[model samples]
Target chain A: MRAIWTVAIASLCAAGLATPASAQAPAQRLPSAIIMYPNILADGVFETRIEMVNLSGRTQDVKCHFLSPPTCNGTDFFIRLTPNQPISWLASRGTLGTGNFFVNAPPFNGEGSLKCFVVPDEHGIDHQNAIQGRSITFGPDGYTESIGAIGIQRLTPGEFSTTLELDGDTYAQCPDNYHFTFVASEPGDPATESELILSTCDEDLENLISKTTVVQFQIINEFEQLLSAATSVRCYDRKVLSEINSVFTRDTLGTPTGQAIVRGVQGAVIAVIVDKFVTPAGAPAVAANEPALSRGRPARIRIP
Target chain B: MSGSRLRGVAVAVALALACGTMPARAVEVDQVDWAAVLRALGIALDSWRLSPFPRMTPTPTIPVPTATPTRTHTPTRTNTPTHTATRTQTFTPTRMPTEPASGQLSFDPSTGIAPAQRLASALLIFPYVVHSGSKDTRLTLINMSNRNIGVNCFFVKDAGPVYGCLEVGFRINLTPLQPFSWFAGQGTNNPLTFTAAPPFDGVGELKCAVDPDLPDLEAHNVLQGRATVFDEDEGNTVAYGAVGFQRLSPGHFPGVVPLDGFTYDQCPERLHFQVLTRQTGSNSSIVLTPCQQDLLTQVPTSTTVQMQIVNEFEQVFSSATSFTCHSVKSFSSFSTLSRSTLGTDTAHLVLRGVHSPLIGLVIDQFQGGPDNSTHTAANDPYLEGGKPSQIIFP
Candidate 1:
């Protein structure tokens, strides 16, 4: 009887250990940083492109939501992209989320939405697979898109980045400030942990990432000059994630994590710089000395 | 003695006869001559006869015839001398006096009695009645005759129809050469007087032109007579006539009053006569009577009429009152109100009346107030009692 009793106590202990305390206590959510490039472009046919990267340790499908933030309180953000641009998609791990957006750019009426999706493989690794992704586009009609399941590469654990090449020659120049927002979500369920990422340069290997980042481009002197560059980036841990959700949900019934990018040219400075650059170039001078290297060789000299 | 004493009785007849015969004889010598005488006597007796003295015998007396013839011849010579002396004495004058010759008379048989020439005639039109208490009368005399004549004006209370023998008093003296003119005089010394009732029965006459006290014949020759009667019981008197009186109105005598200053009361209703008697005819005719209208014709109108108002002191009073008038047909009636104050507090409120382009009336009252006072009662204090409280007119 004593041996049988002891065995029963052990079984109880095993069963108790087998069941989860809070069902794995939802995975910790990572922070996100947004990078934005602001510029004044010449008029005519033009093209604009934006590449998103995931810098989180886990592969992240970054969804970009374009909006007029409170800091840019009075502006209206409306961008046009090629193929009517899908606003929401899934990015595979370790890759850039490239979009070729046209800048004929329909008129923007204020607010828009972007959503991303990431689905993990059987081994719990995030993948850019078609069956496990989801996305939708939103804005005014004809300017709104719902491109479901766009392919996106997932970022590796350490550093991730991308570049945006905007072909400005496609459309007429527009003199106004532009703002962009990017957000990332974990693979699988949208209710799972999500993060927002930010960067200044078009490549990960070139620039550093912080809690927040802002990139401003001034098209002055027919050349783009960086004016005010500032941003805010955040580092997230499991404790911080849990604390945020607990405090937010307990107080307001939801967890809200946001990233804001404020970038624009100082119009006064740009006008002065552009005027200096666009001035006509003088004629080249004739060479004072001729080289004797070859029987008929041309020499080059600098204009005084 | 008869025959020498009776022939002596004879004896002495015989003796005497003897004597006688002797003487006769002596005479007989003479007798012889006697016989011649007897012859002559006889011739004489044929021419004449002689009467006997005492003897009774006719033939016996014949002897004496011779004697008678001789006596007659002597006496005839004596009578002729006496007749011549008497004729001479009767033809001589004794008393001779010195005196001027009498004037001669001319005869113009062709002309009849000369037309009666008007001597001096005067008309006394009294009481023009310019305004109440204001009187203006006139005495106008015309010397139609060429000769100068003196005139004296008189007033008679009860002059009968014949002004002659009427008791009159002297008022004015006018020279013969000059026409008589009388205007209203100032002060209480007016020449006329006013009475309540009409038919004043006042008669005026031009008495002796020469004063009775002055006896110079030259002066008397220039004298003339005139008489007038106030007719219609009006307030005026006029003198006009020849030597006698003519009734202006039967038993109607007008009253008379003196006019010191010209009053506007006598002005026409629509028109006013601004001329003084000195400037106009003494007997001017007006189309419209003073203060009255004439339906026949319009009076000459004037915008403003100049008038003189004199006070008791003979001072002219002009600043006391102002006048305004309105027209009625050809005439106008005027109303007078007090003027703004004169310089001093002691103002002369005496003003008879004003003459405008309208009728004339007396200025009964005048009042004054301060400059700032504009209320009717305050400014025109005379109206406080309803009837003008002050009297400015005569």
Candidate 2:
């Protein structure tokens, strides 16, 4: 009876392969072979809940790297997902009961970026576009904001390598600039606060060397008035918009809503924006969104 | 003995084909016989694919562009914007470049459409979950291109005496780089006048198209938008980007647009939602809007949608729902989506519109969090399969 069931399942699998996997178009907002969450927190009163789902009909092996800033050191792990398997874990707790892989949590009071790529199979078949992911960050004020994982699909089917190129060759190139808008932070009334988290796409994980890039911020108010600010980011940085420059506030911009265009001078970076505000009913609310991406220069990631 | 041999052959063929499509490293072939069969079958399959069979399209070998990384900037220098300060010099961001550099496709040529969320186009669709009254939805529309653009937006309710197809149309003019936002209930009156109609407590969709009357512009794709829906009492908020359909051919503006790939990109056939199964303190709901809608005729679109829930163990349970114009289907009632049935806390959902291509949003809520508060998050459903659909304007 078991053998009979196995034959039946095999027949179904063979029949389903009539339609090629390449026929499926990539959804920029969908799953990719490689996905990244720019900001994950595991500090006091904060935890990041990560959810990843395999969208393909086959099993996938994933290699994940958690990189914290300052030194930009990485903690590596592996996950094995069955066909269409969905898994969720807290960044602070790691995947203890998920049955995929056992990994220790990153250091306490540390926040950084998490990147995972589908490992090519033994026959060297690349399933670079098979997973979709999202991360929800729980904050100290009892607020939670969810951001979809930024997925980068392989431009071509090639053998896996330790040196991943983000240059429209091996994978889709990282964006040159990011455009995002937010309501200005004001002191009185329903005060609003926004945080921008940025992670560099160019890194040498093998040597644990931190790559610093100067980022330029262009601010445009609702009235079309423009001002500029500059900052340096090494590996990863998360900061309140006002801290970079007070011009981000409504008192300085002279408008309630403003748009910021950020560009990295030496390398490319991916980012997520979080905005917290109070509703008319005086209840606290938080909203998060990924910035619009513009393709530009190439960046490289060297894994150990 | 022959029957047993035939069964062996069948199993070998099945495993080979399935393994061919899967990432090889993930598969563990413990038996020597299966491994040998897979290797032999893989070789045969590669040869067959390399043949000139029209149906069996092999993965084309795209030569990796050897373009030396040309962008070299000094570590201390700051990069400047390339454009001057002019109205037409507004900054527009492209998630994925539709036009590949030097004809080398950044994505696979076989995949018809690139995965994108913030699409640049003359038309934008906010598929669902816009509310009023106790709950409010704030909409932000930005003219991404340089130069002035005229905007016409239609807000349609999803439930009512008329089957909730009623619409309120409004117009606004946005300068280059200008963004306009407003609450659905409060409404805006800067040359546009309309408000959410009574019952005052319902959800709907907002469709915004570029108006070519004042600017007399061509079909230059340059509109982008985002929407945030929040509950006043619960203080829960969810935000998402709008779906954009870019016009393909160059011509004067027309009232009716056919999304036949020639005029504009077709809508997706299936939407994949990453959802948490109905567990102790979690719930998921999806809002679907049909791709084919006639706002000019005020005729509602009816579509029968097929939904499949794929559990963690790769078990699939299926269901179907039919609705007119728009529908919000909750997983609370689907026993197959329950944690007990799925045997996991999360599952993958695939929705296909039987009659029309569709677009939608997935809203998730988790209760009993740290402070005993309910947390809500909304995301755009990943899309698959492209099918032609149409939109009629007034």
Candidate 3:
């Protein structure tokens, strides 16, 4: 009788508590109305290929902005997707469609980030949560890697406003914390190194005002020994892991793997990591992974 | 004692033991092969209903205190050495051994589900893996918590005659924060070469699960992994993060684990991908594996995928294809996906398993003009609308 009761109670708990948190909130892996690609590089040797799709059953109009570093200025473009249309373009060459569907100018060079959103139409932006995108960076030596664009869906769609709220009420909130894991690069091993790219969630494209925030990092090695580091990111920034702190190197940690917990001190940020590894014979390989998002906070994206 | 009173006492004692001595107990029985025993029982009752067994069995859990404070750090302007001072603020691992250093540890205590790919405890799937003369895939796995974790992995062969679905199983112990990596051809060096079984040139999927033998720790979603495929001669490489599913329920894990958002998170119902078609002188191939598997019985499962293709002009076309356990579908094979038919260089594709859920990546190879001969890039498609599925583990 006791066993039967425990089993029965456990079954009820399993049925009631099975709904995932993602059902209530948008996840990075799913399609959304807005998407952001934080790492876009086109520096001669490497170029970025942007791909996008409309997952809805109706036509959708999308507006995109490319923000490059140093100044992090914005360049705007327009694209019209008929129902489930898909599109692709090289960041360096830009894209020109048949009619008004095109980019005004060459929107990319060096390195930066790309953000896109569904424009308000008669159908409203509510049904426009079908935009899915990816950015693939490829080099001449067959070195290529890709990152899924972070997708944000509107929680409550209303009258069109320049200020897009990512507060879990208007849209999906920005993650307050990001968990990054990587293998420590060996000291003198020209083969292994990782690059970290970070983009702030707060932006003002209408005014070209980039949000600069200080990011705090708490790192732990295989031994559970903790280390800390900090850096300031304006708009978008990229840096080698060891440049922020030498502890990321295997020689310093005395371990092959380490985990870094990152948080923005002032606001929120999204991050991606690209790793390059080569064998002893000089064969090279590269891969990219996005940090896991935990917690959530409000952020605003102001656009004209 | 009455049944209800006895049950309450059992819960209290279980929580006390879990909070106090979980790590020590995990190490004490590290050598046991409990999965093998379960595999034997699963084969004997292959057709029997096992869902009720997992829920009824009592599993110990260490309840995390509700009001754990979120840690805040001082923002620094530059990369100065003083930034390292925050290391001294480390919180000891006592109250919550499995809690990550993040702000909120939101997880289902009954099901043990974490967000997809974040705190994945149940399974990690590398949908595409290749090993041959010109190419090799390297796998990297990491443990994210403060305690050690044991993992069991399987290499399911995708190409062969009768034994195409053959599985080669192996186990490894991951120290806290440890990152393990090895070439698919070379396998792990420490435990000898545990590469793919018969037929040296093989391609398929790699699935890793938290070792069920570790008492009270079978479903802590603290593992994360990634895979990189690179060319040996040309150095062409592409990498992707492994798809992870966190365990939803904690107890005696059943052989047939349902991915019905109750026992585990549901598998994605549809996958969205965009790629450059043959019109642009580029080729794209998608490697896919079904979410439903019978590793215990070594039986393969097949699912048909319905694809909706949309060109740049908003023109839509539909097609369907079927495959067994694993398959690599090329865009050129389908007329609807070609540049000549679609009249566009690139197209957007949405794929759904007719009867089940699927996971995979799209790999694109471009032909460069001058100094560069060729290059490849790969990325995971966007997933939408999850559906219930099941995995029969060995």
The number of the candidate with the highest DockQ is: 3
Per-residue error at B177 for model 1, in Å?
A: 2.8
Residue lDDT tens for model 3, B217-291: 333566777777878766777777788776655654565667776556677766768877775557778888998
Q: TM-score: which candidate is best?
A: 2
What TM-score, over all chains together, does every model reach?
0.15, 0.76, 0.74
Q: Write one digit per residue (lDDT tens) for candidate 1, span A99-191.
A: 323211222232222222222222221222111111111111111111111122121211322232111111001112221111111123212
Those runs of model 3 whose alpha carbons end farther than 4 Å from true positions after fitting are A1-26, A99-106, A122-126, A187-191, B1-121, B146-148, B175-177, B189-201, B211-219, B248-252, B279-281
DockQ score for candidate 3: 0.19
lDDT per residue for candidate 2 within A1-304, as digits (tens), equals 5446545655554444332222111236645767888888888677788888776555678888888877688888778777666777778777554444532233334798888888867322235567778888876444777888877766544678888876543466676766677777777564677888888888788888878889899887766678899887887899888888898898998866777778889887776778776766776678886565544557788888
TM-score for predicted model 2 compared with the true structure:
0.76
Our model 3 lands, by Cα RMSD against the true structure, at 23.4
Measured against the true two-chain complex, the DockQ scores of the candidates, in the order shown, are 0.00, 0.17, 0.19
B1-394, model 2: which lDDT tens digit per residue?
6999999988877676756665555466554455555765777678787777844334222111122121122110111121112111111111221221222112221223422555456778887645566688777776666677777777776765546687777667777666566666666554332222222236788888776543232335767778778877667888888887766556656768777655666676667777878887787788888889899989898898887787765677888888888777777867877888888777778777888878888888776346755678885676554578888888
Q: Which 10 consecutive residues of model 3 chain B have the lowest summed lDDT? A: B87-96
